[model samples]
Target: MTALDTEVAQSVGDIRESYLAQVGRRRLYSGLALLIFVVLMVSGFNIADERNAGGFWEGLHQIGDYPGEVLTEAWQKRADLPGLISEFFPALVETVNIAAVSTIIGAVGGLILSLLGTRGLAKWPRLIPLFRRVSDILRAVPEIVIALVLIFILGGGPVPAMIAIALHTAGALAKMFSEVAENADLKPVQGLASTGATWTQRMMLGVLPQVAPNYVSYTLLRFEINIRASAILGFVGAGGLGYELRNAMAWGPGRFDEAAAIFILLFSTIVFFDQVSSRYRNRLTEGQAQ
Candidate 1:
């Protein structure tokens, strides 16, 4: 065959391969869609089954029958909105306290771990395996499990929750901080070392400055998460809005309304924090850009 004919055949073969790849991609997407639909269908059936399992119809009827009473009680409390919020405010404050303390404690621990975590600062390559293994072990433990254990040991209050959050946060941020350290520009740290800067001096002027914004950013994010976590810890007897929520739910009738109010407060708190944190993050990003 002529060289021109050979080239045409090769071009046609390439086009055919591309067409097959596109067709395979479409089938893959279709299969994924089908899998998602099946999962939704199964989940729906399970929910329906649970709803109908007991004398659920009667329970629904009871709620429906007394809808007016529920509304009336909730409405009556409108005049006491300030009092209720005030009562719940302490728990909210406790949650904030827990979150703040946890973040601070976690960041300090992470900072210490980061020194070893940073590959650039690492002296012995043999130490890398030990640090990696330790970090891996730390990250493997979930915050919730830590809370459960602390609940058993400490037996109650925001202390257990705070410790739980701090431990997990330390574990998590240590890994992230280490990665940041490993990837950091080593020039400044190395140069500082070459100039006879003490380890602390080098970290303060060189490494710390480079990673400060990121470390602070992560700490802020952890505080936000800790707020939500403090709520769950409340279920296990940690003092927070979650405690109020638990009491309300368990106390029956008018209590759910109180719990719902607390939920509103908690959600608003989160929204406020989110706005503040987002603004700070944006400012930091802008500063970096400039």
Candidate 2:
């Protein structure tokens, strides 16, 4: 080979070596990460098993016992199922109402937080980190923890559950909304700005229109989640179907029929909302694609 050809060949060899080195490093990092993940999982499971009241392995075999008992009792009391459902229907409605109210409030709060935290759309760019951290804190806290605290202060009711779910929903939705908002086209915002529109005006007229479908879709999903959360909160004294379920279960074998009815109502409501939300989300996704 000529000198020039040798130089080019050497450069090619260097590039190939560098690429192989990078790939080797990536593989090493990935292996370490997998090892750490496995360690954490094993250790966490062991710790939980040790601390769990009934022990994980011991309880594992008996997990189906309660369900079997509930089912048997429910079947024997089949005639009372209709009456029990009717009696608990109002509580079910209360649970749904709590979810609905929380979702609306949360959606509105999430929109504001998303706008303020998103990089390009922020009203005060310098405060982006602040808003983001606030969202993070809200999302990081469990709904049950918040509900318990609020129940203590608010004296137990749908109100505590509603507030707890709303706070968590706002934070969760803000993260999703910010992601969607980040992808929004800036041209509309710029146009509005040039026309002397205020920040709120630009957001409402320009950015919001673009992200509204996604926002609504997220809200619907949150609503479904909040329904379950509200029910759970009810068990902790926030009155609703969950509270009724808790009371029924507390009464033991004799009240399994009541528990069964509440379970059925909760499950049916969840399935119904899931279907409704999924349909709307699919439509929104299709519209966005168009």
Which candidate has the top score in lDDT? Answer: 2
Candidate 1 lDDT over 115-153, as tens digits, reads 766666765556877866676676677767887787888
Model 1 lDDT-worst window of ten? 63-72
How many pairs of residues collide in each model? Answer: 0, 0
TM-score of 2: 0.88
RMSD score of candidate 2 (Å):
2.9
Q: What residue pairs are clashing in model 1?
A: none
* Candidate 2 displacement at residue 275 in angstroms: 1.1
Write down the RMSD of candidate 1 (Cα, Å): 4.0
Residue 289, model 2: Cα distance from true site in angstroms = 0.7
Model 2 lDDT at residue 51: 85
Q: Please give the lDDT score for candidate 1.
A: 0.79
lDDT by candidate, in order shown: 0.79, 0.95
User: TM-score for all predictions?
Assistant: 0.81, 0.88
